[model samples]
Target chain A: MKSNEPSFYEEVRVNGISRSDFLKFCTTMAAFMGLEASGVGQIVKALESKPRLPVIWFHFQECTCCSESFIRASHPIVASIVLDKISLDYQETLMAASGVQAEEAYKTVMQKFPGEYIVMVEGSIPTENEAYCCIGGRSALQILEEAVANCKAVVAWGNCASAGCVQAARPNPTGAQPVHKVISGKPVINVQGCPPIADVMAGVVVHLLTFDRIPQLDELGRPKAFYSRRVHDTCYRRANFDAGLFVESFDDEGAKRGYCLYKMGCKGPVTYNSCGIIKWNDGISYPIQSGHPCIGCSEAGFWDNGPFYQHLPSIAGFGIETTADKIGLGLGIATAVGVAGHAIVTNVRKHKEITNTPETVAEPETKKV
Target chain B: MRSRTNPMREVHVWELPVRLYHWVNALCITGLCITGYIIGNPPALMNGTEAYFNYWFGTIRFIHFLSAFLFFFNFLFRIYWGFAGNEFAKWTNFIPLKRSQWKEIMDVIKVDILQVTHKKIDSIGHNSLASVIYFITFLIFLLQCLTGFGMYSAMSNSFLPKLFAWIVPLLGGDIHARQLHHILMWAFILFAIVHVYLVFYHDYIERRGITSSMIGGWKFIEEDVYERHETESKEKAEK
Candidate 1:
């Protein structure tokens, strides 16, 4: 079955891209993967000869943003070549077939490819009830288990699939679980972001196609190349952050001067992503560059961390979401009042005791120990 | 109640290392709390000066990280001193393991919290309740060091900070670790307030020269108190 599949080079040529363009794409992919120039030839050879890998893309409880991001990739070839070459047999958003035809195609791909295919899960799997998110007739959890049962590896495409995004935020209504939690014993490569950078998505696929294995992952199971450095480390506004020049509000003078948005609750320091470096829309701009503080959409439980406009979450134990300042100040004031009251009470009691007591006779001095 | 005017006998309690650790730890915690608060909620210092000239925030962070190191090492010194120093500073004294220690803890609580001052405190060093509280604070200090270094691991390339990098992920990521670290600062602040107040309170009531003992290492105890401590040590040695 695999022998009948056309290689990436053949597919690209048939799709109207020239040999030079394909080689250039390979080189670019190699660089994005953090491979040296010497690895470019290896990528070229692999793509030129290796059969296109079968992929079954699953969408669970999501907004279809990952699919939108993938389709709108800045590089035209990413859609025209990489997407074309992937033999994407099952993606609800992108696949043309629907109803029985789509279900048939999914079944055929699973049966024929078995362990040879890769599973690309784009959203979190809902476990609350089967009725919450269903495809064809099966729940997302049921569908994911069947699809990932024999896949070579699973690539969790975005924050939803990687860390459950907003759907799995605090008080998660759907009991949404990321792919890693649902699937076990398989390498789950997380390309995390609200809608992860398009090139990053393509790069992970390219690495899989070329290397025939999962990429190195960080502790959070994200690709190390893109997720290792914090967004703050590579942010253009880092100098401003270090210098303590911050935008006080959305329309402040500091905002106009391109100051750091940390005071306005930019979570770049804690969030790890390639946004500051690789950037979005082909390196045009990112959240910080566009005068918006990062919402920390990439990190786990980002939604519950705090408000996007505030620096820190008001700890929950207080009656409402209150900042440390309010709580600390209140405690300090209360303590001061208590101390004053206690001092007054002690003074009065001491005065009464002193007046009641008579002068005591001096005792003989004991020998020093 | 016998005479109330007996001359006090001075006994050296805190050693040189203990006194040094106390003041240095106090200074380091103060520095950490101030700079840590700024780091968490930075002020919008929008001075018209060039970004290069205004490195005040960077200086604040530098001082925070520096004091963190000092605090960590100072704590380690205290831990070592607990093992090697005199009986007053020994690990056994802080553990609150014995039945007598528990009694002392209750007695101290009665005097301090319940406002019942009938029972007398006989120990020359830290009372049982204070020692237990300090032990708990030491545990908190260790946690602070772990989470602080874990957050620093991302920014720093040093091997020491790198060792703590796992703490972030293990504690459910950087944001949670930071939150825990930030909240613990308040614990220290509350501890400091109560600790200082209680020290002065005990000094006034017992007249053992509590505050100055931290500086001079000598605590003035009544003759009976000194004899009791001496006899207790002699009994323990014989046992």
Candidate 2:
């Protein structure tokens, strides 16, 4: 089967993508991956010579947004070339086979590839109950464990696989855990976001394909090439933020004028992503550019970081919503009142002691002396 | 009664450096709290036609960074002064190592917190309880610096702030670090309220000019208490 499969270059040629378009696609990938100019040639050489690497993509407790984003990689040539380059042996959403046939393809890939293939996980694993998420009567945890046992590396597709997205939010009933937390002794690359930008996802794949190893990762397991700088750092509206011009309301004049959304509860400053740079839907307007504040979808526990409309997160675990400032201000006022009350009490008690017995106060001093 | 009539002797409790540190730290804390509040909840000022014309937020951040540096250095100076300053200003007074220091703490708590006894516990400098509380406050100060510097590390390329880059992930992430730093500002505000009140109350009850001591570096101690303390120190030194 390996010998019969066409090379990525040959497949791209058959798919009607000209050599110039294919080379342009490679160059775009190299730039996205933060590789130098020479990287374009390296990518072309790798894709032309090397056999397509086997990829086993699994879906668990997630929507198929990672699949959607991947298949829609801005350019049709990119989507087709990347699809052919990876030789995706099994993907739950995109694969044509289902039921017995789908399970057969998955099992065949595991036995066939051994440690030669990469396992790309799309969602979190529910540790609380196996019934919470199951595919073909097998638990998600079971499927993930079996997939990771023989994979070259694991690519956590989105926040779901990276940081346990919405399903793992506050009071996460499913007890969902990210892929890295569940699996160890394997290199896991976190492409973090609600649905990470398609170009970023493609860049990571191209990097793995070219280097035949994982790229440099940040502390959070995200590839430093894309997630190193924050969206705020690269934002075009940063100058407006520095100038203190902000959108007070969604429908205000500042908003229409493209003022900074910091006052509108933008989490761009804290979120690490390439949205401001790579953007979505082929470098079109991202969330901030379209006048919606970032929900910090790339960050862990983003769901629990209070309402998306507020800047400060609500302090967790009081059985009700309350921001840090609310609690802090309450405590401050209480302390001031308590101090005033104590002062009154002290003065009143002193007055009473003076009126009652002057010698009583003097007796303690005399004894101490 | 005899001690009340005894001549009051002016003892130099705080050195000049200690006094300077106190005032500077106070100013830094005040500026930090105000500027930090603005940073957390910035006002939506839509002034000027172009972004380049208004630099209010930038100016606010500059002041915050400036005060933070001043506050950090001032705190370090105080730590050094604890070792190098006069005996009353030494670290020993705040550590609560000795039995007598623990007893004084209990006595102060009883008089101040419980209000069960009218007995006033007096010391020439800061009482053991106040010194110990200040020690805990100093720890909070250090945490504030760590979180503040950690958040700044993302924005600053300087070598100093970069040292604290690990604190953000150590405390989970940038959001948590910023939350802790913001909440601590309120802690400082509450501390100020209790601190100023206690100072005035102590000044009235002890008649030691405790409020003015910070400014003048002198406290009036009863002759017998000062004499007893002097003799005890001499004996301890001899040992």
Winner by lDDT: 2
Steric clash pairs (candidate 1): A314-A322
Model 1 fnat value: 0.44
> Model 2: per-residue lDDT, tens digit, A141-174?
9999988999899999999999999999978999
lDDT of 1 by residue, A1-369 (tens): 466678878887888888888888888788777899989998999888898878888888888888888777766678864367543687787777889998988888899988888988888988886578998788898988988888899999898999899889878899999999988988999999889998889889888888899999999999998889889999999999889998888887888888889888888888999898778887799999999988888898788888787777667767556877778767877776776676665555443232323221121221211
Query: Against the true structure, candidate 1 has what lDDT?
Result: 0.83
Give candidate 2's total backbone clashes.
0
DockQ of 1: 0.45
Q: Who wins the DockQ comparison? A: 2
Residues B1-239 of candidate 1: C-alpha lDDT, one tens digit per residue = 53345557989999999999999999999999989988887766655555887889999999999999999999999999999999889999878889999998997776456544434567788889999999999999999999999999998999989989999988867888888898888888878877888787777666678999999999898787788778888998999
Q: Return the lDDT, model 2, position B1.
A: 39
Report the C-alpha lDDT of model 2 over B1-239, residue by residue, as the tens digit: 32335367999998899999999999999999998899888876655366978889889989999999999999999999999988888989889999999999998887777666777566778889999999989999999999999988888899989998889878867888887898889889989989999988777666777888899988888676788889988999999
Docking class of 2: medium
DockQ scores of all models, one per candidate? 0.45, 0.52
* TM-score of each model, paired residue for residue: 0.94, 0.94
